[model samples]
Every structure is written in C-alpha cells, then in structure tokens.
Target: MNKAKILVVEDDRAIRNLITTTLETQDYQYHTAAKGSEALLEAVSFQPDVMLLDLGLPDMDGVSIIEKVRSWSALPIIVVSARSEDRDKIDALDAGADDYLTKPFSVDELLARLRVALRRARQDAGPAGSPEAVFTNGELTIDYAAGCTYLAGSEIHLTPIEYKLLCLLAKNVGKVLTHNYILRQVWGSALPGDTPSLRVFMATLRKKIEPVPAQPKYIQTHVGVGYRMLRIPEGGPAAPLGE
Candidate 1:
C-alpha cells in the first residue's frame, strides 16, 4: 500500500520540525513549506493526500491558502495554529479547513483527527463502478458521487463539516435529526457538550444552501431538539414539520 502524503505548512521551524518528525515516525510520506506562497506551490507539486496548515504564514494568511486551494481541490486540510480564538477557528473552518488544532496540541489527537479526515474523504469518494447518487429539492442539489453541492444552478462552496452535515440532512429529508445523532454521524462522536459546535456547522450549512438563511425554507429548526430538512413537494409550497 502506498503511504499517505502530507504537506505541513508552518512558518515556525521548531513546530514544523516537530510535525514532520511525528509524520516520519508514523511512516507518512511528507513535504514541508514555511510560507504561504511556498505552501501553495508545494500543494500543487506535491499533491498531498492531506495538509497540515498554520494560519500565521509570512507571505499570506492560512485562510487565504485554504480558500485558494479549495477553489479547485477537495484535499483535506487540518489547520494547526496558535490562534485559539473561536472566531479564528470559525474563519478557518468557513474558509475550507477540515479541522483545527491550537498550539501545544497533542500529537495523538492530531493523528486521530487526520485519520478521521482521511476516512471521511475515502467515504465521500465512494466505490468504483457504483452508480452516482444525486439528491435534489427545488433549487438545492447534492451530488454525492461528485462531492458537489449546487444552489439555484450555481455551485456552492461548503466546508468539509458543512458538506457532511448537509448530506446527513439531505439523505434523511423530513426526518428530525437530533443534535446528538447529527453530531455522531457527521463528526464521528457525540458528547453532550459538543452541541454548540454542531449548531455552528448547521448554521453555516444553512447559510450556504438556504436562499434566505434567516427564514430558511429548506432546513428548519425543531427548537430545543434538532433540525429537519424540509421535503419540497413537486410544484407546491414547502410545508412545516407538523403540516
């Protein structure tokens, strides 16, 4: 089996060395870059299976790198940064990061997240010779086989987590998926305290898929329970949960 390739983009030499050492110990084929511009070039040349990115690059912001890469590829990106602020994490995630880890993160946890990301990527790729599965409702469409989402004839960009959340709801349209259920299915685990993270991802997903996020016509909140993706009737108006 071919070892997975990883690209580590961190300006700090110490941190970069530590990450590369860990990757080497794990038997991963890896490359490193110390600047955003170099990272972009390496990403194209290396074509890594996954990436470890730092937000504080000298040439450009890591979020910008994420946005630029996401413009064409679905490569998994795990952000490793010292910025522990929620806004920073949200920004990176919204910009296309698959996961975020603050400075002084445990190597074990990082490896676990990397495994999860790789597994999700493989699942999303589906199996060879299998028929494509495409789900649609009015103007919203999800092409599971192609790993793409479209809203009103235009392709929509969704973060890894957002796309997973949307797929879960879209697959089970009209079913009220509890927070715990959605969290476990999309995130691989569910803790009572992780509800807020699930809510945040759901909000982001709605904003990308809903015509009016404030008055969401497709995804509806059940209030205190969970959310439901409304099943649009053919040539008819969307109905509420109980209707």
Candidate 2:
C-alpha cells in the first residue's frame, strides 16, 4: 500500500514539529500549515490523503476550514485540538472532520487513528472509485443492495429505523457520528427531545447484534458526542444467541 500523505495544520510551532517528526519516523509524506488559509490552499493544491487539523488556527477557526474543505473534498480530516470538550469535538465532527484527537494525545494513539482514517479512505475509493455494495466488519455484514444485515451469517431482523441507523454507522465506520448528524440522517431531522429516544433504540439494536451489550465490540457510544461503528478484526467469536 502507498504511504498516505498527511497535511498537518497546527499553529503551535512545538506541536507542528512534534507531529511532523513523528510522521517522518513512520516514513509518511507530509506538509504543514500554521494558518487556516494556508491549510485550505495546501488542501486544494497538495491534495493530501489525510489531514491533521488543529481547531484553533491563527487566521480562522478550524471548523471553518473543515467546512470549506468538505465543500469539494472527501479526504479524511482528523481534528487534533486542545478543545477536549464534547461540544468542541461535536462541532468539528459535524463540520465534516473524520476523527478527533485531543491535544494531550499520545503519539501511538494519534498514529493509530491516522491509520484507521487512511484505511477508510482507501476503502471508500474502491476499485476504480466505486462505492462498495456491501459493508462488513467482524461478524456484522450489511448488504446494501439487498437491504439486509447479518450477524455470524445469520440474517438479523431489524426495524426500519434500526436498519437505517446501522447502515448509517456502517457507511461511516471508524468516523464519529454526532447525535445531531445521526438524527438527521436516520430520522430526517433532529427534533427536540429525540436524542433520548435515539439512545433507547440504539440499546435494543445493540442487544440483537452485540455478543455482550455491556461490552460492545461493534457500536461504540461517545457519551455526549454520538456513536461510532468500530471495525473489528475478523475471526472473533460470533454474537451470542443468549446470555
């Protein structure tokens, strides 16, 4: 596989150096920008495979950069910021960031997240730029064309809403989907007091697909932000029929 190109957009000299050095250690091709304007220019000109963005840029807010880049490109954008609050993460994600890494993140974790984004990017750019007709992660399988889902090769029945939710997460696997984003996609809009209902539905959906709902291996809850569908490795035990 070709090493993914990365664009590092951080105004802090120290943090930029640190990230660039780490990328170098991994032999990754990278470019840097200290301001949002420069970041947008590089994003269009260089066309990096993935971007590491800092929410606080000298020229403009990082979320603005995300929205602009998203207008034309679907390349993975991972927000790396000091804004660890759930609201900040949600804002960046809603703006189209593929992932969010808090400022005090570990090098290992950052690299791991980058790899995941790259993998998703490659999968998205399927053979000759076509979207995959089916989605699979671990024991869960989604046949988009047939509108069916399976766990351990057993067809699992899902309500219309549950199926929609599962498909949404599967399509954006590895990327965080904020509550609002999910609501809009799954139910048409995020109505007031609907988040709580969404959570309840999610619980029932998990019970059907998770081997152990208490320790989910597929769908992950992000507290205030939203949910993410994890890409689990193949060969795991199948979802238990009964506890």
Candidate 3:
C-alpha cells in the first residue's frame, strides 16, 4: 500500500523539523510549509491525505486556512497549536479543523489522532456512484450527484457546511442522531461547547428546507437528545412534529 502523504504547516523551524522527523520515522511521506500561503500551495500540489496545521502561521491565521480549504475540499486537518484554551480549540473546530492538538502533545497521541482522522475520512468517503444520488421530500430535493439542492423546484444555494449537515441528516432519515455524533461527523471532532454551533447550523439549515422553520415538518429536534429527519412518505404529508 502507498504511504499516506502529510502536509505539515508550521512557521517555527524546530517544531516543523521535529514533526517531519517523526513523519519520516513513521514511514509517512510529507511536505512542509512555513506560512499559510505556502501551505495552501503545498496542499494543492502535494494532495496530502491529511494535514498538520499550526494556528499561528506567519502569513495567515490557521483558522483562515481551514476555512479556505474547507470551502473546496474535505481534506482532514489536524490542528496542532500552542493555544490550549477551550475557546481557541472551539474556534478551530468551528472553522473546520478535523482535530485539535495543543503544543507539547505526545507523539503517540498525535499518531493516534491521525489514525482516527484517516479512518473517519475513509469511512465518510462516498461510493463509486453517488450513494445518495437523489433525495426528495415534498418541495425539498437534494441531488448528490449534481451537488445541488432545490426547494419548490427552484435551486437553493447552501454553504458547504450547511450542505454537508443537510446531507448527513438526510441520509439517515427517521433515525435520531445525537448532537455529539452530528458534530463529530460533520465538524470532525465534537468539543464540549460545540452544541451552540451545531444549533446555529441546524437552524440555518431548517430555514432553507422547512416551509415553517418554527414548526418544521422535515427536521425534528428530540429535545435535549438530538435531531431526527422525518422520512416523508411518498405522495404523503410529513408526520407530526413533536418527537
């Protein structure tokens, strides 16, 4: 099997060298970038399976890099930053980092996280043909093959994250998915304080898909548990809202 390629983005020379050495020792191929601009270029050229990013890049904030990359790709990003504050970690996760590691992390922990990220990435990969080629419930429709959503026969624009969240819930229709599970599946890793972020995304998604956001017919919340997608029956109306 081919070794997994990793792109390490850190401005500090010592830390960068250490990570590269560890990568080499682990028999992984890697490329290095000292700044965010270089990191983006390397990310494209190298097409790494995963990325180790530093939030304190000299050229740009690592959060910005995560956002930019997430806009176009689902590349797994494991943020390794010196910022240990919960707020900082949540910020990175919210910005789309798959995992977070504070500086002074153990090599073992880092490798374990990388393995988890890779495994999740592989599990989340879509099938050869579109697995969810098309999903429809009344006016709302999702065409996975075309990467588009439509409501009332008109195409609706959704941000990348919103689209992803919608697709996840849609794919598992009629089953209640806990908030933590949704966060981990959608945002990569679920942090303790990430519930509010999930709520915000869910609310935005509801507004787009539900005819009545307050009394949503499709997406239903399980009050203190999680959310569920009501599997609309063919040629029939959605079920009652309360779950």
Best prediction by lDDT: 2
Order of the predicted models by TM-score, top scorer first: 2, 1, 3
Residue lDDT tens for model 1, 20-98: 9988888989999999999999999999999999999888999999999999999989889999776676678667676
Give per-residue CA lDDT, model 2, range 1-243, as digits (tens).
347799999999999999999999999999999999999999989889999999898789999999999899898999999998988988999999988988787888898788889888988888988778888888888999999999989999999999999999998888889999999998889998999999999999999999899988888888898998887756753222110
Q: Which has the higher lDDT value, candidate number 1 or candidate number 2?
A: 2
TM-scores for all candidates: the values are: 0.57, 0.94, 0.56
Better of 1 and 3 by lDDT: 3
Candidate 2 has an lDDT of 0.88
Candidate 2 wrongly placed segments (more than 4 Å): 235-243
Q: What is the lDDT of every predicted structure here?
A: 0.80, 0.88, 0.82
- Candidate 1: list runs displaced more than 4 Å: 129-243
Q: What's the C-alpha lDDT at position 126 in model 2?
A: 83
